[model samples]
Target: MKDGKAGAVTELKPSRPLDHADALRAHGSSLLLIEGNGKLDKVTVKGDQAEIDTIKDGLAEPVSVTAVGGTGWIAEGKLSYIIGDNKGKDPGPFTLTPVALPK
Candidate 1:
């Protein structure tokens, strides 16, 4: 939750704060995914913000993507092998057949 410039952290008031014209940026070690605005970006925030008080059931497995938000992913074999994106639900459960290795 610290904002810095050049090499020092500076405090700026809403009136004198730096321009947010670039973008609303935040960084943290962990993140959580939530639902909002009929989208999936509203429920995300930096870990330092809070204990990630999610109202929804939330994703099965949550992973932090650069301290931005929670992301979904499919993993297998104790996380040794994984495939596909799990951020969102799978409307249709597809199958992944293994290919025969070289004889």
Candidate 2:
């Protein structure tokens, strides 16, 4: 995650396509919900000392503001962000394996 101007970049590869709802439940953290039709296919970090990596179909791009607060998940083809109104809503069973970063 990026903090202010300086940010630390980390590569994360999910074992499988994670369901949006399941991700939120697993992370147990609140997220912001936005609305938009922009498709995010790749992310490249550029700079003199930048550590760049490619993210494919990991997040839905051009997120528009649709709600205030909610949960987020990284799926196979797209990222999912649901509003808080969906609280207590079960999205069924999902599997998520921990991804180890390169040392």
Highest lDDT model number:
2
- C-alpha lDDT of all candidate models, in order: 0.26, 0.28
In every candidate, how many clashes are there? 3, 7
**Cα TM-score of candidate 1:** 0.19
Candidate 1: deviation at residue 31, Å?
A: 7.3
For candidate 2, give the lDDT of residue 79.
Answer: 31
Clashing pairs in 2: 34-64, 35-64, 35-65, 35-66, 36-64, 38-61, 40-61
Candidate 2 Cα lDDT to native: 0.28
TM-score of each: 0.19, 0.22
Q: For candidate 1, lDDT tens digit of each residue in 3-33? A: 6546554433222112112112233333323
The reply for model 2, stretches above 4 Å from the true place, is: 1-48, 59-85, 97-103
- Residue-wise C-alpha lDDT for candidate 2, range 54-76, written one tens digit per residue: 22223333332222123123332
For residue 67, model 1's alpha carbon misses the true position, in angstroms, by 15
**Best-fitting candidate, scored by TM-score:** 2
Candidate 1: where is the Cα deviation over 4 Å?
1-51, 64-80, 83-103
